[model samples]
Target: MHDLIEALLLGIIEGITEFLPISSTGHLLIAERWLGHRSDLFNIAIQAGAILAVVLIYRERLWQLAMAFLRPGHAAAMADARVYGQPPREYAYRLAAAFGVTAVLGVLVKKLGFELPTEVAPIAWALLAGAVWMVLAEQLAARRAAVLGERAAITWTVAILVGVAQVVAGVFPGTSRSAATIFVALLAGTTSRAAATEFAFLVGIPTMFAAAAYELVDVVGSGEAAHEDWSALGVAFVASAITAFAAVKWLLRYIQTHRFTVFAVYRAVLGLALLALVPAAD
Candidate 1:
């Protein structure tokens, strides 16, 4: 029962933090200090649940992207292409480019055996650094938006940078993937907050699912699956999906009117507190 409760709490944390410009992995790591450590497979499973929620939320958009290729001359596809002054399949192509970059770099990172640090001090430092990065990036993006009037077009440069951002986030546990990608897109001249956020979230769906699959295969090959608590994992998965649905929905709406500065402020405070507390605890 206690384990189940812990699973539920961890799921809620994953769901709430996953889509936000706050690091979900950082939150999970902090929670594990008290709730007890979870296996990498369990963490990946909960993250997969969050990814499923994004999939559901963007079902129509995903369908349109598909139909754009599968059925040329699709009305929605034509409209999108016309508005963006690009080919009918441009959006899809950009998404592919971004995902490709991540896949290649991600594999290289894995091959190099660069693992996410589990230590609190490094995570705390990352959180603090990310907060500073967010502030500076947002200011630059806002200035660009003022001049460009909130352009929605994603340039090839933006696409490639966003992809690189994802790998950087993966290498740093406290750097939020969504935060990294979205800000990189913004800084790379994708001025519209909504557009940057959508691209980041869309790209994340596949990136995260791939990572989760890779981790799952590794865990199974190592025979660690046999020791996992299936019931607790199931509860965590369901809890993560439901909470993620709500969290992403809220974020989509929230970003339309607000800047991401609030999240940066929250990150700064939390990071500093952790930094102070961690040394004393040691």
Candidate 2:
């Protein structure tokens, strides 16, 4: 019963923090230190649940992208007719390029064994750094708003830039993937918050699934899965899915009217609090 409760609590934390500019991994690490750590497989699996929520929420867009990929003639017709706001083909290409760059860079980093500390102190520092970047990104976005373009108008250069930012977020624990990608898009001249957020999450669906798959395979190969608590994991997975759907929905609505300054400040305060408390907790 205690384990079940812990799983649900951690799932709640994961769902709430995952889509927010605050790092979900960082929060999970801190929470686990108090509630007891879950296995890597369990963590990865619950993330898949959160991803399932994203898929359900964006089913319409996902269906359109699927049709565009499977039917080249339809894509061409849409492009020629300009039926959709943006050519599905162009959006598809940008998604591929952005995901490709991150995959390549991420694999290389893993091959090189470039890993960071999962310690709370390091996460605290990373949170501070991320906060600074967020503030600066908002300022830059405001200045360039007039000249900025929408998601469909993103160029190859911007896609690559945003992809690199995703890679950086992967490399750094406290850096939030959504925050990094969205800011890079904004800085790269994406004026519309909705457009940037949409692209970021769309690309995120595949990237996250790939990571979860890799982790699951590794755990299974290592025979670690046999030791995990399946019941607790199931509870966490369901809890994460429900909360993630709500959290993401709220964030999408929130960004439509507000700047990211609130998130930035929250990061700063949380980071400072962690810096002070983590050492004492030890």
Candidate 3:
């Protein structure tokens, strides 16, 4: 019963933080330190719930993209089929370009045995650094007077830049993936905040899904899948999916009319607090 409760709590945390410009992995690690360690599979598997939320929210657009990709002579007809003020093919191509870079770089990072510590200290520092980057990137975006670009405006270069940012976020636990990719897109000249946010998340669905799939395969292959608490995982997964859906919805609306200064401030303060409190708790 205690384990189930703990799983529910962590699920809530994962769902709420996963889509926000906050570090979900960092929060999960901190939560685990208090509640007791869980299987790495559990940690990764819960992300599928978050991905499912995204898919549900963007079902229409995803379907359009799929149809565009499958249409007869799509490569030659992309100039005609526009959906949501942009060609669906454009979104498909950009998403693939961005995810390709992330996928390749992520594999290389793992193959190279390059990993950052998931301890609170590293997370704290990353949070502080990401906060500063957010503030600066917002300021830079404001100065450009180029706030007209949408996801349709994401060029190959912008996609690559966002992909690199995703890779960096993967390496550093405190550097939130949404935060990193959005800011990188902004700095790369994605003029509108909504555009940057949408593209970041759209690309995130595949990246996260791939990661979860990889972890799940590893767990089953290692024969550790049998030892997992399936009941607790199911509860957590459902909790995370529901919360993530709400969180992402709120963020989408929030970005349309507001800046990300609030999240930046929160990250900065939280990072500082964690840095101070972690050692004492230990």
Compared with the true structure, all predictions reach lDDT values of 0.89, 0.85, 0.86
The full ranking of all candidates by TM-score, starting with the best, is 1, 2, 3
Ranking by lDDT: 1, 3, 2
Tens digits of per-residue lDDT, candidate 2, 77-97, equal: 763422125677778788889
With a 3 Å backbone cut-off (N, CA, C), the pairs that clash in candidate 1 are none
Query: What digit string (tens of lDDT, one per residue) describes model 1 on residues 209-238?
Result: 889999989999999999999999999999
Show the lowest summed lDDT stretch of 10 residues, model 3.
Answer: 144-153
lDDT, candidate 3, residue 50?
91
Model 1, TM vs. native: 0.95
- Candidate 1: worst 10 consecutive residues by lDDT? 75-84
lDDT of 2 at 136: 94
List runs of model 1 lying over 4 Å from the truth. Answer: 75-88
Count clashing pairs, candidate 1: 0
Indicate which candidate wins on lDDT. Answer: 1
Number of the candidate with higher lDDT, 1 or 3: 1
